[model samples]
Target: MSNDPLLDELRAHEEQVWDALVRGDADLDASLLCQSFLGVYGDGFADKSAHVGQLAEGATVQSYALTDLRARALGSDHAMLSYRARFMRHRRNQAEDMYVTSIWQRTEGGWINIFSQDTAAGEATD
Candidate 1:
């Protein structure tokens, strides 16, 4: 695995987003996701505006965190972050944990999440 500080740096960015989500800070979330951000989830797909729009429209995320983080640099200007994300949404019956991979591209300002896909981790066999 690549032991680059970029991993931690991006991880911190991801945490910042989690904080923003829980707080329903759409501006913060907007700053982190790219203009063309695309999120692929179980229900459907969402674009950048639509993604943050939820928070802007009063959607609430109770809490969230990422674990087992691993990042791979895609050339010099991009990286892929893989981890297990656990989070709870407001009014939801229960929390959900999913395996997630987010693609971030480094730009003049900084890194912005450009794409993300979530895969549900089914019940443990053991």
Candidate 2:
């Protein structure tokens, strides 16, 4: 972890998101996102409902690890977090690598994800 508190805090929030995916906790996942949350994935764009809806069948992700996290303040209420993620989906034998960027906004409730983008890091090797 880094010495920066913002980086650490944001990393924790990011991990929560991944944990939700692994556990298929749609409620937890929904709680972390803003009503207007937008996600850009290799497949296409997704809104908050679509993002949370993926968990309908339970546990979309099997496991995940985040690394090389970086965060920058986008004013006082917002911050951007970027990192590399290696994760395996449920029923998938191979893990996939991706670089992700997420924007979070501080609200009266707490930090909520406002936007995110994921770029595939080519293919995973054995």
Instruction: Give the alpha carbon lDDT tens digit for every residue of 12-72 in model 1.
Output: 8788878888888999999999988999999999999888988965648787878899998
TM-score of each: 0.91, 0.95
lDDT of 2 by residue, 5-24 (tens): 99999999999999999999
The pairs that clash in candidate 2 are none
Global Cα lDDT for candidate 1: 0.88
Q: Which number leads on lDDT?
A: 2
- CA lDDT scores, all candidates in order: 0.88, 0.96
Residue 52, candidate 2: Cα error in Å is 0.4
TM-score of 2: 0.95
Model 2, position 41: C-alpha lDDT score: 98
Q: What is the lDDT of residue 76 in candidate 2?
A: 100
List candidate 2 stretches off by more than 4 Å: 123-126
